[model samples]
Target: MEGLEIGLNGNLVDAETQQEGGRFFAADASSSNYILLQCKDVLTLEQKEELKRLHVTLLSYPAYNTYYCRYEPTELDEIRALPYINYANIYRPEFVTEAGLKDKLENSDEGHQPPEEKRYEVYISLHEDHRNRLEQIRQKIIQVLGIDPELVNADAFILRAKLQSHEIARVAGIDEVQRIEEIPRLALSNNHARVDLNLEYIIGAANSRLVVGGGLGQIIAIADTGVDDQHEALRGRVRVIEGSRNTDARGHGTHVAASAIGSGNSLEFGPIQGTAPFATVLSHVIVDNAGNITWSPLMFQRAYNREYGARIHSNSYNVSHAGIFQQRQYDGLAQDCDRMAICLPQLVILFSAGNSAPFKNVTSDGEIESQAAAKNVITVGACESTRPMTRNPLTYDYYVAVPIPGYLALNLAGNRDQMALFSSRGPTKNTNGGPDDRRIKPDVVAPGTVIYSAKSSQLDLTLPNILPGAIEAGVPNDGRWSYMNGTSMSTPLVAGCCATIRGRIALQCHNLARIPSVLVKAILINGTKWMVGTNQDSQGFGRVNLAKSMVCFSNHLGCGFWPKQESDFARMQMIQGQELKIRVPLPTANPYPDGITPRFSLTVTMCYLDYPDQSGLVDHLSLKVLQKTRLPDGTFPERYGNKLPGEPADNRNNVQKVIWDGISAPAPFQHPDPFRIYVRVERLARDAQFLHHFALAWHVEEMSRGDAQFDFWNERMPSTDARNRFMRKD
Candidate 1:
């Protein structure tokens, strides 16, 4: 032997004895004797322990099957001689010698030893194969890392824990580990008037007792700080789940809940009813008393969907990080949300695009926050509420003066159609770590500036606000109602609208309680009217209009979608290299500007809840529409969803829309003209063999400049044999 080493216990060391931390080198050995060991496989716990006995310190396993180590020159042969070892090479230090390490250690407070490592709060995502064994894997981690039980979160799929930085590699070495990312801080990121949404027209047109058929029998869940169920506005409608507090200490949750389903309780707060006032709310308090989000969104989704039967989940919070102007990466938190959405196809999850506009430069585009960047959940942005700018002068002035160079301006928040200066915009980071692969976000915008909603009585009115003069602009001295501003307010409003869409579909389609979330999204997007004041990326398709969405469900409109087997309205399922075509009839009745002329426009939307992939490349479906008849120019017109008049099919989003604005098709007696449109859905990827389901919604109406109105009484429902054909191959 070149040299000999002994353990601290004074025994002659062998290659099999196990020890902890740094190993004892031979008395004459120095730090320069350190070497790197590359192995063919991950070391077993027993092997890791055995290496400590051979006077070798396993410093770290920085990469797969590789270890950085310090060892005695004599023990190098034994380590290299191991059957599993690939190579052992010297590890050189730039300038350090044994003297430097000794001097550094001797000056230490505890004498001759390195200081303790710092710990970090991290969110851990396990491999998909290990998802079902989450609890078992978590326990293994706890046992291996010696973690405190209190630091571990009770999540469904993803795991969150407090661990030292060095210990992270150990966890990554676990077979169940898929990705490791630093846990970014999460913060709250939302509403408007009923008139802006044209709710009155929708309610009156439906002739229902409440908005959007009163969102009958639908349950909307809200995950926020906490809700005060005792509040007069939300009193009888809010149900706080077990393990979640019902009291609103921070007050954010109460406002969010009320925005979604507060009954308005006219006896107390006049007519400030929520969008879907009749929908029941399942309140899940994810935030602590300090206003920090205590639970991951996946945890809330699991509880709300499985335990409470809430298919509509609204989230007002998203991950935040300093200097992170836009969430360019579809990080773990977003993946968690998307995973849940995929698992629960019936659940319509919504998240607020963050309120980080003031922090962005004029060149900034993808300012959407983490969880809000999820591909499945609908990300909502804020538009100026109809509320007069005078009511909140401070907020109005602040918006005009916000530091975003070319984006902020005076009177931006005064126009109901304008995008809010503080609302987050997006092309949701890039997917799979590529620059040109950005996805559009803020699927729709709603009123978020100076939105008036319920307030928590238990909250301290004296507390400071996050935004300048927010307390003065939002909270009143009485504390019964609040006038807040954020995408948070917008998100719940959309949630309520989603509930309304769900309820309306259930009533119209033979009580279809489990409407595919994609259908609801399709209906909602199909109804959106484009906003003139904002760019496409900033406002998405446009601000949501409930009246228009409900009109798509009206029997009069020549729109057809599925789950209505009675009317032959069925969704399409397809695999790779397959195409599904839906034929939609154009209303032939002369109910237009002229008694004998036909002038109409059509809108078609296709949506699907994509199957999640571990590689971040989700399933894609393309949508295209071709008119069966030639226009006056002697040419057949074709349109692709989200693309220009003749552009190629869109492959970037799960939802696609095509709008035919002004069409004066050939007469009813012309050749090849029953006046129908063929909508096609094509799958572009063959990554999986499972069948993918998609919903197609189409709307046709006579082009006229008039108030939002639809005569449903005289409307003709499509007959069972109305010749709407759906052709699909296996």
Candidate 2:
């Protein structure tokens, strides 16, 4: 039981003294113990060995080269057998300082600390071999400081370990595979040439009146190819981080920046404007002309370190192969990596899920590395939209479908109907042999296929780059103001949306913290759409429907299924009295401003719990409303009241009840009000389940009034034979 104690300052003492005095064991420097020797100016291995023979174990040395140690009274073999050595220097003075040691010593006052400056005392485990050495070091520190060694405690320090950059060339089964092109021969040339702008869908889904500004007027660091600061869309929005020579020679950075928050006119040719046009862009060009990108976690940290309030960051460029090795020494410089602005809660760093696809094992190399893989950041993926092209040559216009005889489909060419095979997909699985921790990747998807956005004409207009071959393949006239596709293209869409959501939430709720990244994610996921045949993995949640999402949030519509009531109170009154029955009709369809489908069943139930005067009078009245009903003006009312009314409205006379069924609908009902009801209530005040038997019948209606032809409702009809049968039978 004889153990040695070591301190952070390299002081040591015997185990018995440590236990009785209250000192505890701390860290082990055996792996990097040489770091301390070098700090002490012990140059030779022989000198180090000689010092070791003196029974002194060297602890860590501060940056100032101060060496500290403790003496291990027991032999190395004996020390190795002890369960734990007592170390002293690891104790945090803050805890004892903020809350006086006397208070902490009182068992009754254990949890009673000041609200603002609370602290916790902790202990760290040490290897058996290093136990005595660490203990000895602790004692020496107490001796040097001349403090009561017994009062010493230990504090746990978490080391910031950087993960190596992982590169995957392709995502399995998704990348490089040509999506089957359905010939655009609808037989109607007018329809073929004329694209549906679908502006109604966009306008209906989004609330144009609610503008969410992004970020402080402060700067956000964007590591990408050089941004187009001069471009009208990004002109005032961008603030180039000076001192760093990084510039977007490749134009990738510009596209990424534009996607993040390009405010240019949506009417102008090229792609649509970004999600957060009002947010300032801090452009940090990281990609060069040769397609060589020089970036590290350190570079991003340095950029943001200079500006603290810069809460937003977008890194579209990544190194495929750079990460921290487990055995490597990352004590100083590497530890500083966590101090990066991106690591802070206020800053939201977004990265592209990566362009590599079709090979699940491969990704955009460093795209999933630090910062992107960091716990707090948001990662976005791309989704292809089936929306037709908008042609307004005066404002902005382009062909959205493929021209005859072209094989390669470049996004800029305006084929919005297809998804680019290269856009990355993920639930970033554990890559380094460990637990299968799935990093929720691609928080949301956005229009990435054939997206027309601002592009740098400088790169796109040059020779072969914009030649017939390139044009035939669908590359834009120049990289500028051209269209592009990839998760890179998709990520900024979500980032912009995030800024918008954050801004609006902050303005309206005055509760910014309530808007966690997860909620922002929920909005986007809940509004997305799956492709013709893909599942959740390919089209996570759905597309980013900012307008619909904002409305849902405003209305307190959560992601869970809508609440249901077993019985309709309105129908129960009829069964309580023996009176003449009256009929109410139900609507065949739902009526809401927005033509979205209801996902659950609508029902109403009525029960006669108690009989009048204990007479036990009950009646099973089956009443159904005719689908047809007339208003005072003789025109059909929007819906039929589905329930029946009994005369002698007073509660003592008679009672009636009705129950709505879980009926499916093959096609949505056009109108949603004046629903009819069917009632069959038996006298059952004594029966517990009788109350459950009663149901309410009301017409389900859409909430918004806008053009319905262009709505996503076109895709909501039931196609399953079983569901269709259920709907028809009902």
Candidate 3:
């Protein structure tokens, strides 16, 4: 009465005993025996019947495997049953025999390796089940061949052939950089100008004799629509890193790279140069034929890690899908990608905020989504200029597609305060209660509306069909020099600015990481002008004023208003019976270098009305030191209120305290030579509302020395100035 066991597909079963322990059998009787068979390729009918005759129960048979299996199982009783198998219902079978399994594992790299190799070890990315099976097959191979698996690893390694020369040539020529050609007056039209980028601004900001980006030997990686190396503006500056089959497929990348560092000049039919002008470009194409940026950040990581001396990477594409952060796969990849991006010692990654403007809600996925959301990368947004118009009013034909008066001639006036409605708005907030962390989309906003830059000759002319009126207006619309607008246009502006700052810092300090924080502070404070009614959400810190920033840098005056101690100070103070208490406000700004110390001067003007009884007790004032306190061990002590070397002591007489009488009659002061003490006023009536006004001025040597920046003000001012003005009473 021994229990019988069976095996199928190498699954062991004992006919004498039902216990689990037994020698491996090729077939089993129980329905569970089907689990042992690997369900990969199809099985034959003969194999199925052979399996059935061996008393093995078949759970499923793949169409292709049906030819390998023999004799299908049928009922033994007096009952007729048709085989419950159909083409659609058939399932693939796994390798049953040891030799079959070994063959399956060994053939994994069949087509991947070169033909010269006798044997190849393939690195296969497989599911857990397949990996386990492969591991078992490896052990069996070692046992049968009497060789160590480690020693066999070398013989098993696969060898792949290098890319063909033609393929390399094709990729190299994909986005061949071209020289910019000057368009004649006949070609000059309104449609062409709309796409014209402000190359002047880019060049002007980068014109610094003290700093040149030419010999830094830093490589800037561009992931976009591939570059036009043949463009005159970009001629010798661009170097292709990775070119896809669909090279020259798009002009976005070329335009972006040129805007950042084009070396040609537009006036002489020369190159329409960029901001850097001499920085080498390492181009990598990421966009596809569908006009979509489908490549993930992993591709960027691969590109970055492949080379040793690469630093900066720029991408002008944005994602449309918003749920990337919610998915585990995307989030993990994003974090890893960000780490990879910032891993380089001097690495700086830049991304376009997106073009989904006026809408203000939509965003993209992968790099676009990750860059905007990633803390390490710089995300750029677009802003339009509203300064008084300086250019002449040129008459041009208007577009019929535009809702405005069509077919009418209009002056090209630049005095405007409007921003493009299509430029994307960020500080991305996800409504879906997922990990909706608020990302400050654009760290800085640059001029992106109707920018002019170099383009490729191969660009499809049909693209203008999207906006026929824009094309016919002759607004610098040539395929080489286009006037496209969007945050995509704005991103390179900031990236160029970053390059300029980095170059300058490298010349002076030899550190690149210092540039990000320094530039962030400068742009946030000195370079930014506060626009009325705007908050931090929309406009952030306002427009980037390079002139003002340079001025601040030279003057050493820290940008932005320093926070006064009064803002955080409490009013009441305790006084001891035996001693008088004196309080002084501390200076909020950091001190300059030792020899060039900041000079702080305070002037107080006091007016007093003569009273008959108090005439003889005229207001008296004197300055004196109360007590000097040491800073705590772990804390950075306040510097302003600290007592100087020499000073008089606080007096008990109420009428002898420090005082100011006015311009005509000044009050006496103590200890004026070596050092002055805190000024105080006495003899004031208890009910009096004493006017205590003082002006504190200090000189700052360099704005770049310390952090003097604030977040940008959003553009959301109240409808009326009176309602939003800080000084207004109403």
Candidate 4:
């Protein structure tokens, strides 16, 4: 009433709410399509059609002069206003207001406060030619918010409406509102049966038994607590998801869908595969069997009907801790699962990082959980392998339908590559509220202790409190197996080693569906064995090597990308210190001239995906390296005179990485230079594109011999179709 304010289009506009925090929503890049409200006003054109039926456009009737912003834009800080100027730009301050919300909205009551009906759910973002006038604005949002223009959804451009609360200011002053709020009420979701091939020999990939023909035409999914697809290591593979409920009755989604892509056609044990056992499972029950989890009903029930292909989901489940900051409702469901992984380009979502026991990198054990500490989901964590769990064969008589408990065991004692004191450590430091959630994360690590795979003889194979009489209670079991540990078995061994590195880039670089899950998460965190010196919050950017991420994606040795843009300004560029460079050339087909500085060992990574925007604008982007050799008295390499060596005017980290490790060689070849790799996409917060698509990944190698040497370069990969045209590398 008085100075109004509830304007996320629940009407009652005229500005007042910005005293400290935007009650429901608030934006300001010096006001883009204006939004600021205070509600319960003096209204009714059915409350302005319930503020245009909860999709509120621009609301300002008279009380338009209220500005108190020190920033309130979200969906993960793309941070804008550097000079969209207004509130006297004091050192570039966006907006900050108080003075007791301007003397309690200029001293209250311009009348009418009784008329509540409460029922909201909202999340509208329309305006793409108003989605072809969404059923004529869904019959004026059901004749002014009575709720039933078939519940108005507009199927994603963000629109989730449910109305009431006085029909939300008659649907927030619509002109096809580009933003609306309220939708964070998640209801939510483990592991073990084996160390899964001793976690494929602790991430070295079972010493190259590399069945490299991994899950072709990929498809993971698995959500959880339901995958029992007639388990004999999932003989019929599995699909479910349609209306979910394909029953698992708590066998824990058929042993986490046979530990990510299992299909060892079950005898119950030999090589207990999965980790993309020829990938393709979908599953997706969302924790039933009394585990009770609910992520927007299976992400809008498998996005209602169809269209979800290119996936890798596998979220070993965790939530209900919700503390260490970062929550735009789990970063708006991780920016809608990173807009379906940049629109499904080898999509990978993964999520574990929460066995929640140990913690470091400057304290706090209760941090990285929920949607696995959100922000574009990779998470993972849980290293293992000192080798111990090997039980199950006292003259074994393997399952001819179920009987042999023989020695009935599943050991995996933990000690190998270490770091599994429950595995869940990371700097994650606060996101969705962005700026600096520090980022490190469990981007790697694998082999959950005591691992084994596929088990769903249908409940009770154990767990009524570990080994208490080692199971027998009505065991009908079919293709049953055993063992269990955490970081939910190291996130499906990095989602089945990203489907065997996208099945070796679709069998030797034919370009496995254009390989890209951030360049297979930067070639598995730059082919980690440990990002060269651990404790990046307990070994992230380490472990999970998958045979050095399939020989660095078959010798392209760490990829790079920006590719997929066809609109909204193609290459989405906005470089500041300018330099999108690349020069990773060391194994130049063995061209001698060991001319120093070629001791090799580098790791890159870069990662990108942002555009749910609220505006923080320029988020730091960096990665530097320069060596252009020469000097042993031959002149040429100068320390950044015009810039190169560690060049940077900007660097904050979207997912940055840079390690050297070794550097000795230098005896000189009179004129041998070239090691450059500058990428710095700096811009504090001016905007033109808050990093649209980046995926850089690199690896240089040669680290002082004892086996750190990966690709001495050139091992045979490229083989395109229609008779050859592949030659493309930068």
Candidate 5:
């Protein structure tokens, strides 16, 4: 309205229809009495005056924020809504980065005489057993810090205090004090993005008829800016955070939530839906009107506890850029949350690999960014789907198409299956205790091109790009749907993949109720189809194949579902230098009715939530696979702690992958009778949190074409067998 002119070819008509003056107004779907006029560009003074004359309120812009009007313009000091009783909470981030807040916090500490009247925010971790010393520590902390404390966790026995964080360490001599660390400035992660990542062909959502992969029994937590619960695509499915109003103001959170799991059943946008339509998304608006993600981790804990807890958390946001050298406070908080996840195996966090792009971060030459460095969480990057074509330049020539992900020979932008130029790459900044320790990052990549999903209706009221003359202007609006691109979009696809998998695992459909996060991570990586000419930095393992992952989890495609006679599950907590070994049978490949010789392999992957080492290092855990063969005495040589020469062994990463390949003339196959997984957790620094909790997943899979087996699922008695899920029916 600001820059629009009012003229109609000398016809002198009212500004109600057509390009002369009324080129924008689009009527609301439910009521023709309402009309929308979204200005293609910023408004001019005349357009503003015209909009005022029409009594229209400004809403969103190219920035994608949803603003109905200012609080004062409505003449209200506060939002009277039940949950959003306070209007100030609606503002965006005041500070998005830790460096900015660090200066302020440091400034608050230097050259100042403490005034008893002033209050500050601080975090304290107690060393004593929480069950018995919780109250004791609370009273002692209050007495020493001389300020009130907000209890954060009873198990970890953590607290946020009004006392300055630096002062807490000074008072640690006052008993019950273990360690005191300053809390970082919390801000919402900026994931502002992919559609095929959510599409059925890639992830098997529609292929399964929406029964298993459509997120039937899974729940996801979207901790971001805000979600517009009233949006047609998410109406019945959204439950806003308790204290926040059920609406989106920045529009980022809304876009993210809908893309990850929107139902898309609403009349306005039924043609498109989220990767996990049946999944529940709980919104936690950590970013305020100031546009920062700097809220307390306490808020996340509360949301995590909601409705029996969410199985997966999709975070399109982060604490800082990847160059941050393993942030102490933030990384600690992430690890603490991961510890909670191990206790509840289904709880896993998925983070965007980041959008830093072709250029590496200053702190790290690798693309790995801040929150994406966490050990337990799944970090995802952006990969675009592309098709190749060739044509003669000087002569008349017909274009020939090349298939994608595999077909494209060289990495090129605007081409399919290639790693997105914008996705953060990785050789993560040293997470291990030493400067030399670097781990492969961005565990996987997914589609992150121009992805179309539900748009925020509450946001588009002003910019009706889809109505009337605006369509000719080539706006990217489709009424209730919008297109976005980034790692943010790709991450949700992975989260939805987890949801779909868990739905089949936990909903009485499979023999096993759950699988360890590490196992799932390993299976997903194992199942991925590698991109052409990609490395550990650009694409960790490869693109996740939803059908393959599902096939593996169900004990098909040569996988052994845990808790079976040959498969097993265990949750372990080990101390520094301690080793835990789990052994599962190794099956030999045999010929089937098809008369094709098959090969076999075993995979053992162990995963755990790693906290900053007492020395503040990140990586300190390892998993090893050792072959155990029966000797002439009919006893396994490695069974009695005896080491045999020529034994096959691999002690790789915390995410260990061991395989026994076939077709070598020397052995033909390397299938050991029983495979032993030795997980050694090393603590270089004594101050390290000694108890390392972990989950182990062991499976025996056929490396080649093998005989078919009976379906494992028995409606009467569940079994971790694959016959019921994926074999040609008899």
Candidate 6:
């Protein structure tokens, strides 16, 4: 016991408990013992085994050198007496609250319950390994707090319960509880979207039999208020996975659902086509009639549901006040989404970056909060539409214009090149509670201003906070089609694009399982047309273009999932310094029109689902394309993902891209050189046992005639509708 220090505390200590000298003292042994144990060094396997032998269970080590321990109160002193221990203090839930809240709770009137609205409904996350003990902990909390039994809902890793201000601290003191977060009431956010995204061109190509299908035989899952499955455009293809289609009274979800896969005509407009007009939609109604929403896990429940067969999930809603607790809260929806991604590696999840741009208190002009800040999710933002608004010509400008004092507003969403005023921006705020972290958010943007799509028949179009005489619905009297705007419109459109790509892969690769989510993500991002003047924080990797993305895939080397030798993709476990190389052949020179100077660009993208951690990224790999031949200057030409040659490698993001463009037509014809793709792991999660997995996709393009080449490639490629495991059997 040379360097050991021990103190005592139990589950029922109230505000009156003294906080002197790193101790809270002990009470009765009615509940399990939870001690915040800290040590100078990380505990060894033998040391951990010794504690287990003493009947003490180590819960989790979130940050610092501290470990959460559960044991009988009698064994506290005995464990503290062990040689490796430093300080074993009582776990104080009150310490988690902000300084202001601590003061308010500590100095408040006794027997006082916070206001109804202030009594937050929160999800208490338990230690990952303690999931089986969730019910036991919840029952203990119910017995101790005497709360109504109906208010709690338990899952594999979380317990959802409504708690008053004082009860938050008491719940945190539970032995198995890891963290708590207030459930956010998500708001709807969506589109001249089809034209802006070049969906019309892709659809036309597919009709000509130039491509496999425009998202044909694919499924996209939308988790929103609800979808109007009976709507003319979405009637046959839309299936309700959670809530009924008739429940969409807000019209937001119906409009969003249509933006992705709607296939019929609008009442006013001739044809209201979605990005993926042929793709099926699975609707998960997350919002209730009273406008309340479930916690994060329930919001994305269907991503892994085999019956839904939805590999792509598009959510157009986000927390009302975005970024307020983003940096401070590590156990919020963002963490939940990250954990979900780890569990379901093939699921592609997209979230709206929120419509909180006008409020400085919400955005702080930089971070997007909650699920939008999740590392594994593709956070989407809004860009102005190129086509004119149908109902009100300048509605985009009117809603986004500077508002009267005390209200949130900004002037940014009019021009096609500019970002929408209400679209949240990002250089995501790191989790301040743990390690330093930051990543570029709003992964991509699409035209989201004054978009027309299917509207719920039962929806009441009237909403608040509008200009005195402005119209609420874009189409004044049309019952079937309505126009709306926001990242919500853009998100589903992107999801449709993902479905299109994934669908094509499923059809093209006859022998594989579902195309890896990372492969599709890489291909979509790799083909992006970078907005020359804008930075990554606002526009991400630029707009999603189907024409450009289709051309990004190799014409010769096939891209397929794992276990298929015909596929160009590779998925392997990598450790620090472990490097894998792939040789991506460029398209052979093709005869072009006389005056055109043909240019070729080789783009490579790699993505991996990393282990979840406090520091946004748990695993990182660097992508670089190396040329075989050395230049006359004795330096071999190389391009790092998103970086110029000779710069240091990027360590920030999980998705990486390297584009080697502008090679003269003669070089490929003369040399036929293949870009040497190198993927190397830089680091792994703390608990990761030496290895992590990743997927890599590469393509070579003839930039001078990209569309012509896209059509040509599709015409030559074999076409079939090979549905994967996620396809609905019912």
Candidate 3 global TM-score: 0.44
| Order by TM-score, highest first | 6, 1, 5, 2, 3, 4
Clashes of each: 6, 131, 100, 62, 40, 6
Best by TM-score: 6
C-alpha positional error of residue 28 in candidate 4 after TM-score superposition, expressed in Å? 14
Error of 5 at 547 (Å): 1.6
C-alpha positional error of residue 135 in candidate 6 after TM-score superposition, expressed in Å:
1.3
Candidate 4 lDDT at 727 equals 18
Candidate 6 TM-score, C-alpha based: 0.78
Write one digit per residue (lDDT tens) for candidate 6, span 15-64. 22422233454442335456666655556556767877987676654433
TM-score of 2: 0.45
lDDT of each: 0.63, 0.37, 0.37, 0.49, 0.49, 0.63
Off by over 4 Å in 2: 1-208, 211-220, 245-247, 265-272, 298-308, 319-342, 359-375, 385-418, 431-435, 438-440, 457-480, 511-519, 555-730
List CA RMSD, all candidates.
12.8, 23.8, 25.9, 20.9, 23.4, 8.0
Provide the global lDDT of candidate 6 against the true structure: 0.63
Taking the tens digit of each residue's C-alpha lDDT, what string does model 3 give over 1-730? 2222222222232332221333333233222212223222223345345445555454222111121121133322111111322111111122222122234334545576543333322212111122235444444434544544563221111111122222222221211100001100100011111112222222122223423453244456777767778887778767776445323545677777777776555542344545556677777776655454544444555555646334567777654533222211112223333444433324567777665442222344212243454434566666653322222442233222234343234443332123333444544433121123233344556666555677665565454323222233235524457655566766665566556545555554433233332232332223433334443344443454433333322212221211123331121121111112233233233222234322222211111121111102112223343222323665321212212323342221111112211111011111112122333443332112222211111111111212322111111212233212312110
Let me know the TM-score candidate 5 reaches against the reference structure.
0.61
TM-score: which is higher, 3 or 4? 3
Query: What TM-score against the true fold does each predicted structure earn?
Result: 0.75, 0.45, 0.44, 0.34, 0.61, 0.78
